[model samples]
Target chain A: MMEQSKEPLLEVRDLRVDFRVPGGYATAIRGVDLTVGRGEVVGLVGESGSGKSISMMALLRLLPAAARVSGIARFDGVDLLSLSPRELSHIRGGRIGMIFQDPLTAFNPVLTIGAQIVEALQLHDRNLSGKAAWTRAVELLAEVAIPEPGRRVHQYPHEFSGGMRQRAMIAMAISNRPQLLIADEPTTALDVTVQAQILELLQRLREELNIGMIMITHDLGVVAGIADRVMVMYSGRVIERGQVDDVFYASRHPYTRGLLAALPKLDGAREALVGIAGTPPSLINRPAGCAFRPRCSHAEAVCATAEPPLLRAGQLESACYVSDRLSGMTP
Target chain B: MLRYIFRRLIAVPLLLLGVATVAFFLSQTTRGDPLSAVVPERQMNNPEIVAAAKERWGLDKTLAERYVIYVSNLARGDLGTSFTTRRPVSADLAERLPATFELVLAAMTFATVVGVGLGVLSARYQNGPIDHFSRIFALLGSSLPVFWSGLILLYLLTVQLGWFPGPGRLSAHTPPPPPITGLYTLDSLLTGNIPVFLESLHRLMLPAIVLGWSVVGVITRLVRSSLLEVLGQDYIRTARAKGALEGRVMIHHALRNALIPTLTIIGFAFAYLITGAVLTEAVFSWPGIGSYAVSAARALDYPAIIGVTLLGSLAFLLANLATDIAYGLVNPKVKLQ
Candidate 1:
């Protein structure tokens, strides 16, 4: 399912973000390199505070003013970071769209769903008339499978249920036919059944539009179902990344293996789940060595000396020095 | 929405009745006889004159009978007779209400516009020079007594600079315009008397500003804090993510939400200003209801006092109703039904 030969839609290199704090600057995204090809869905999986969302937000310059971002984010041959605010705004919700985790909060409560969608449409296309935008907004809602698009269009966000609001949010996001869509935990706030439906809707939309997507979530199940490639982050850095099948089945990093081990199996007899010991390290004052060293059972003396770089092998990349020696062991 | 308004309207009379009962009893408890103001001093010893005066004003009846009579008269739209003015309280109020309305409306409009504008600017430029200046302005406006500010402004603008006309709604040389709405500015405008209109507006400036200053202070702080909170909302971020420029984001998304709370404050402030601009009215000699209320209190005019209190309560109730209706209109989540 991996499409390495396809031209990349978004290429980000050495993306770093530091937020101003009371004492000093805290490193949020230490260094992240990401690539999403056209018509592909790349899963960015990590625990909370792992910089999964911050890295994507930084590319769009959507972070708070206190955050200092330094990176090269090129989307469709345009260096996003270098673009002026005027130029960058054209790209935001125009060439690139974003969906937040909580749709209820993401939407303006006072504005009707249709008006919000029309706003997004008119922001990119100045010539779009209010009537035309309203018509298009209705069509977009119907396209997202919202019931009675005409009536739902006039309804407010609070009137919509969690699942329906997410659908409307997606409708607004894709109102301008964006080339790339960044869904930040789109289904995390939804119910299990609704999550499946939203995932299906996203998959269908991605295929029909041939849009590049970055799916940010902590749910492994979501990534396994829809993602072509996967990147696992820990403490503001990507520890492992590869094709979804390769990374899931033959996971190399100790943290990745621990994550796989933690997943509950439906086929096997009931058993207590194996959780990774200790929490992710704090980004403010991280230990000098590997962030996952204290939690890793296979930690060695060298692991305490320096953090290992991404050691790529074939279709997989893992930031672990002893992964080669542990290849034969099952998670 | 109509049903909601109707329901609110239904409660108005009952609420007014409560206000009337409270005002009537409170005024009745005061240590003064209504006849004292109505009859001459020598008549205090004259039994015939005293009895005639008590009988004419219905003061000869028992307290219960008097209350029943007062309530029955209130039901018939008579506010009884004022001891000081010797005219029906209702007639006195009718003549004075418009003047107070014009003054309070002008003050409220000024307060809302300037207060909300300054608030938005201050919040947009948080921690900047404008923010600091507005913060101090609000602090000073709230802390300074209206009478002190009114006097100071009167001395500076009228006595020192002679930039504006000294008191009253119109100049001493100008005759009153035809009383259409009983508001000089509006009445003059209706009659196409530009000079009277301009003169009335000029005379109105200092009093309105002094009366509105404290309300402006309240509304500014409310809007500033509210907008600051709204600016941090997820929907505001969503608005920005949609490529909305800063101006659009602030006005379209942030301001509307911020103004919801501010709207409630503004409505109550307007109600308060109507009867509370006593010092401003006295200083400027605008001949509004605030001064009427003060003189009524000084003479212990029960009918006039109760009538003013009833008007104040009615304003408060109506303001509350308006705020609720506005809330329902602005926030769809609030079910008007």
Candidate 2:
């Protein structure tokens, strides 16, 4: 089943990013180890300020000037963190594609969608120009299923509807045909029908292009529907990692269990949504033991005193003291 | 677009009417008669001569009748006659306008180029020494008086160093260029008189710097704040994420959006330069509308005073129209209402 010999497209180990604040530094991403093999979708789930986006942004070194990032992130056997800005830029849009949320603001209002896509393609490959770039842009727009690609390509961002804008952003992202795609909340701003369509488009692209993707979202339902593997984050740490079926059916972490329980059940009688009480801990002064101890209902003396490692329990791994008891909870 | 322009142009006459009525009433309502400066103090007792003088100047008519005559004459392009010089007000204004236009253009170009450069530098190096320098420079520009700066520039650059001629349009030795464009530089260039053009440009530099400094301050501060805000936007981040160079992100993504808000300031800045040119002209002895107004004000010349005010009002109206057009051009999202 596993493609054992081929290296993963992108592998990140012990990646840490610290943001210098007014006093000290706030560790936004702490020791996040993730690997995306070719043709696999890894859904990273976390609430707000959970470092889901930070970890992904760090892979490309896209944080602001004040951020201090550390650790090794290797892509195709090359160290990403050590690459010069010029070389890293080559790898950014050339080898990896990125799509962001809020496509309205993500697009430059002054330029046409086709122009932006052409710019993306040109930035990666300097030789293509004029008719060639224009044709490639039209092809990208058509790939995203936008109608009348030739006519619509000339319109500015304001002329596009929200769903159309997101589609255009997707076209821009996939313009270079990179091996890996990092989609950060790609469907958050979309309506239900549009969200489904975008998700379907993503699935179709993943299969046809055989591109590894890291989908960052807070929606567990989205993770369930499309993600091949799931990695749950809390504060600045990834607390659990497993196959989608393993994590969905036999969740081993209390935090993951809390997230799964909070979802509104569609199959049975509608029950009150179970929200995990307590807000996420501030990363500046992270909780001593486990970052989720304050919110975890199964917290014990060990859970409050010492942090647990993400050790393998057969087919899955979770950072918790009482993983055995939390593993068998029915959704 | 045509409708939008027509909507803006339609207000011009209404605004002119309001300005003229207010200017006439204000002159009448002031403490002394405008004719007092012209007539001798010893002739105050001669009621017959005074009534005759009033009739000649149309001052003997009722306020309503005088206003109607003023509007009708204005419509016909007659700006009346000056009380002191006994010349057509329109001719004098026409003679002086080119000087003011030349000064305003030079000052605007210098201020915008240098000030926007400083704003961009400060924003790029935010919280650094460049930012601090730009902030302090803006503070001095906005606060320092124009006449005071004009004198300081004169003392340092002209009087001390003896590098530039002190004030006026040209040296007494250089003959006036043929009046092709009215502006000395253009007229000199058109007439192929390089010496006159150089002298006119030389004399203009000091006052232009004096008038431009404050506007530079305003532009720098405006560009800095707006650029900083734009740099933080998600589009800028997206630009960087797309593997664009840092320079491309700043120029293509950030600066274009930041320029929209700055355009409004530029319109008002041009109007302010025209008004400030008055004080600057009075100090520098430049032969412009401003100096003409000052000399008229001293002599209580009602026609010249009214003419100057009308010119300024029109300049401002035109500037506002230009700003609206530029606003549309720079920002495609702004569909004129």
Which predicted model would earn the best lDDT? 1
lDDT of 1 by residue, A26-121 (tens): 999988999998889999999899999999989988888999999899898889999988898898899899999999999998899999999999
Report the lDDT tens digits of candidate 2 across residue range A1-331: 3554387878899999999999989889889999999889999998999999998998898888899999999898899999998888888777888999999999988888888888999998899977899999988889999999999999898899888899999888888888899999999999989999999999999999998999999999889889999999988889999999998888888888889988888888878889999999998887889888888778888987877899886478998889987656664
Clashing pairs in 2: none
Q: How much DockQ does model 2 earn?
A: 0.71
Write down the TM-score for model 1.
0.96
Root-mean-square deviation of candidate 1: 2.3
- Taking all chains together, each candidate's TM-score versus the true structure is 0.96, 0.96
Look at candidate 1 and give me any clashing residue pairs.
Answer: none
Misplaced by over 4 Å in model 1 are A1-7, B33-35, B42-48
Give the Cα lDDT of each candidate: 0.90, 0.87
Candidate 2: global Cα-lDDT?
Answer: 0.87
- When candidate 1 is compared with the true two-chain complex, its DockQ is 0.75
For model 2, what fraction of the real interface contacts is kept? 0.54
Candidate 2 TM-score versus the reference: 0.96
